[model samples]
Target chain A: GSYTTSSQQPSKLLFRQLFEKESATYTYLLADASHPEKLALLVDPVDKTVDRDLALVKDLGLKLIYAINTHVHADHVTGTGLIKTKVPGVKSIISKASDAKADLVVEPGDKICFGDLFLEVRATPGHTLGCVTYVTGDGPSQPQPRMAFTGDALLIRGCGRTDFQGGSSQQLYKSVHSQIFTLPKDTLVYPAHDYKGFTVSTVGEEMLFNARLTKDEEAFKNIMANLNLSYPKMMDVAVPANMVCGLQEVESKPC
Target chain B: GSYTTSSQQPSKLLFRQLFEKESATYTYLLADASHPEKLALLVDPVDKTVDRDLALVKDLGLKLIYAINTHVHADHVTGTGLIKTKVPGVKSIISKASDAKADLVVEPGDKICFGDLFLEVRATPGHTLGCVTYVTGDGPSQPQPRMAFTGDALLIRGCGRTDFQGGSSQQLYKSVHSQIFTLPKDTLVYPAHDYKGFTVSTVGEEMLFNARLTKDEEAFKNIMANLNLSYPKMMDVAVPANMVCGLQEVESKPC
Candidate 1:
């Protein structure tokens, strides 16, 4: 009904970036304030910080509809299962490639909708086999701000290493070039983890400046294959817990 | 075998203070390097940082003989259970009053030993019902240095809040004056948590300058009773997990 861009209209949509200091993980909360119900969605919720996130949701008077993960993470345990436990009926969503039990297993080209807003899913599996980027729809307005939740595929100045759990430097390069960089140069890139305090970056900035990912395909693969990074500290415990969508092994068993 | 004081003989003993930034928690590692076995013990291990701790233990080539908690913590999950899963035969020790299942239930006057070094347990409840201070024994050398692991019962220039989990102002005051303040003025005090980047303090400094605990008994009680602090963010999860000595609920029981 209105020609004004919703991105500029703060009252129409709600968005927040929450950080978990322990793991340097960023959790994004997006809600459609335009809707009467204020339907909301959360991305990459850390288990230990659920109390803070939930309190925030209450304070903002938003009703969370989905808790989504870009992939099964290794650095920190997800709060997806715990959030579901806390707010009954909130859907748990993840990529089908993850093969983890989730309420909704989304694939490439899938659209997750809330009220009038939708996020177009684009599989960007370089960091992990199941990694995906959620791109916001431009809506009816021509100048609406487009955001890409890049997960670990494309970091601010670097990209996720292609050494863990089905990681492939070639595939990651293709995904970034084809799926993410193809978007508008002004599109904002938000990664799942940032250790050096960076919060957000734009596609054009990464395209010209991302030290690791912007290189030619052959060079990028060589860098990722030989970086020889150490295993993440929480990998042993976080992986198993994240596979079941962050449920403790005991909690997932039949009662 | 030698007349040199233990503190002066640095090669005979190894001590390190590890910090968990999220909680500002300090985990101390003390080893009796004089022993042929290179026996080591960790105090206040945090769950998320277990891998880091274990890596350090491996790097030092020390045999981890015990993992002890200052008390059941509310800020972070203790790594006691996780450490047990990683290293077998390492005893888990805690105060008997904590009622948490541990490999060893220690009381006042009891000692935990690693090679020739020993920690003399001193009951110092009030921060929590089961808080205890572990005072190191002085060796044969007169005027040998002694250290007290005071946990939350005494901080560098402050003390823990006496408002939750059976906390008491009067008992905290009495415990500090009778149990901790009575230690030799030169005795070093290592607290379980320090926010101001302080690594160590002496009993004399705290006795004269500890703003909260240095006051007269009645005045100390008044300060603690009116602090009115917010509940810890991790209390709900940490309390239950710590009760079973850091065992995840699922691992402890049948479904």
Candidate 2:
């Protein structure tokens, strides 16, 4: 709730918060407006909304460089593979730990550069084994980063479930503390999913207001262990589909 | 807005209106509850909602018989192929005129029978080459068929545009007048898509109040021609996927 966007925001940096209602997923689009290539990258592109995303890219005269995923999602398939077919030469990037085929295998500290800006990856696996947070500097000319795409490891006032898909409460708690909470207190946090209509949050706000994760490490682990959660409805189809970068399992295999 | 569900509805037929919010598609589940097989049929099952639909079928203790599409959709993939994989023995049904592969090819005047009720097919191709409306009697005890699934042919207040994909204003006008308007005055109409949140309408209501189709033949054609509607965002993906019973085109053939 403490999220803010300044009116004097850098003109060279373009950002948009795109939402897919079916899964309540937020896809972030960041581009360098001043770059001749109009280089753009999308984080967490959804399979169902690929056309809409592609249309927006064409409308902005931006050449998509990377279709990235924060993790192999359980709620919906990623659009990375499909985007590769639509936009020739566009690369699909994901964490090496995800064990999925992609154009680029990223690791912690890896910088995914596009145009004048780059997203610095931070390993924050808790929602899933390959979950990562992407941090980027304020603008092309700014050296200090002020925004973090926290995926599901950290949400507005809560965090992702640590019960399935290689999730660990202790690790999630530690990851949030070391990788996310340690960021600049005012840095903006854009999460992958938000069911309650929250757009963005801040490290300072989440550290103090995130009810589920603000407790001591032991208490946080206990909270996660005792929390009874329902499996997402799309898990069966989404996981397998996402494992192949959004291609249906049957389609990916030969007869 | 005029839609109504009565508690005293006939006990022999089980009916549920399943909605996929992504495409604003309404899938109708109808079953003859008193039959020993409990033969259930779905009209316009969406691809992404297959799990949800399958859950409903299992919970209802009904044996799914057919996954019927009103036409080859251009907004979202159909669940016919996926549903067949999940619910073994379920047949994919569509109009033979659609030129799409399915288990059973239907035609105008065909009767798609389940346990006790049957859906009479009426060719109403204006939105596409093989669009059809399915009309079923209220119940065994009722004398008149009072429900029609009008696909994209006859919407709540407007009909499908005659701008692309074998669409024709003249054919659409003729189909509505002869096949739809002449139905029982009280026949309830369930459209495939409704962006304004309307659930149902009556033949009597549409004839008098449907904004786009109530005019004379020439006026209706002009209305259809002047729609100037934007293409659906998912058309490219949906049409190709649907042509193969919702299988992704890339996955259907050899690498």
Candidate 3:
């Protein structure tokens, strides 16, 4: 559902926030008068909760123009393909550097425009080989992008695992220190998953408290090596299911 | 491998303790003059850790007479089958009420004798179906049990999960109050797994500090239901592998 603001400035940008607390996944739907009927994007949508998202889109009277996956997830199943099936005209986008299959892959420094909204893709491969973060809006004249959707690359108090496929601790260190950490400190950081109780944090908070980022390379590697983390319980089932984007055609069965 | 104690007592009972701090798995090897070659029993043996236990047996010049499982574990694989395979003449025993496959399944009130050492089995199925606690004594003359191996049924400061298969909070409450709590307050409680720093506790301490048992039933159920426990990462791999007793015929692979 849409809520109206009382500001008479005629420059208010409307966006709705939805969160799947179990997975710590945050999906935002941004819309305005210029993109009323056919302009919307979904970032990191979860598989089982697609119905709630679809309801929101229908209630807002907006067409899903694109479904974006920040990266292949290790925690939960992705719903990119499922949205495409339900919303026929929507395009599924990912980093061109990713090894996973996608319909429309864009490279770094690429720009995607839907109505008045402009998204600039930045390739930030630290947590995984093809991880990317989208920078929405251009300069101060445009609405300041006060948010970033970091899919596993960065978390509130911790970082992503670097022992899995396409993972490199060094690359992640660089990605955080150079790209994400350098962002405006006030930028609200929305991570893909949060194991701890934290839901969100500012860039300043992460730069100060993130355990891995604060350690030197040698210490970080030793800490990562000593971590007795078990593999994700759904890896065997979720990976294959996500490869096809939420098992679009497969019959659902009891877990 | 063997240490000598110069105690001038008529009854000679020397016991060696092995501790796996990660899983809180404690194994005991007891030796007496009457059953030198035929009175060895292993408690709470973990998968692939059999080599260490076997080396201790060989060094002490004692034959392994029995291998026992305290309960079907949810966190780690059991090594009872591996011990049985390595020592062909040894008999593997578990509580007859267990759903898991076993050769010699004994019930509650059953007594197992090994020369001068005797163990009385008590059916304790709160943690899981077929869980049993073995009370070991030097002989009938030893009025008190020197040790009790409680597999998941009781922990140092906590209790086992009742959300998994065959687990019941009500059953657990009954098991702890009637069977375990009723035991001598000073009886040593050896648990299967303890992630919290403590290694062991007495029945009296548990009755006083066990967060679950001390609370009312409704409060206990709420605590259990809200426990933010993730599915064990190795559950899928460990369950099937443990079904055949630590992959007897299958080649071992690094976990």
| Candidate 3 error regions (>4 Å) | A1-12, A247-255, B1-255
Tens digit of per-residue lDDT, candidate 1, span A116-185: 7778899998789999999888765211457789999998778888888788899999999999989887
Separate DockQ for every predicted complex: 0.01, 0.01, 0.01
- Candidate 1 — which residues are off by over 4 angstroms? A1-11, A141-143, A249-255, B1-255
Specify the CAPRI tier of model 2. incorrect
Ranking by lDDT: 1, 2, 3
How big is the positional error of residue A225 in model 3, measured in Å on the Cα after superposition? 2.2
The weakest ten consecutive residues by lDDT in model 2 chain A span: A1-10
DockQ of 2: 0.01
TM-scores for the candidates: 0.50, 0.50, 0.46
lDDT of 1 by residue, B47-139 (tens): 977887786566556899999987889899999999988999888899997777788989999989888878889988899999999988866
TM-score of chain B of each: 0.92, 0.92, 0.85
Here the TM-score of candidate 3's chain B is 0.85
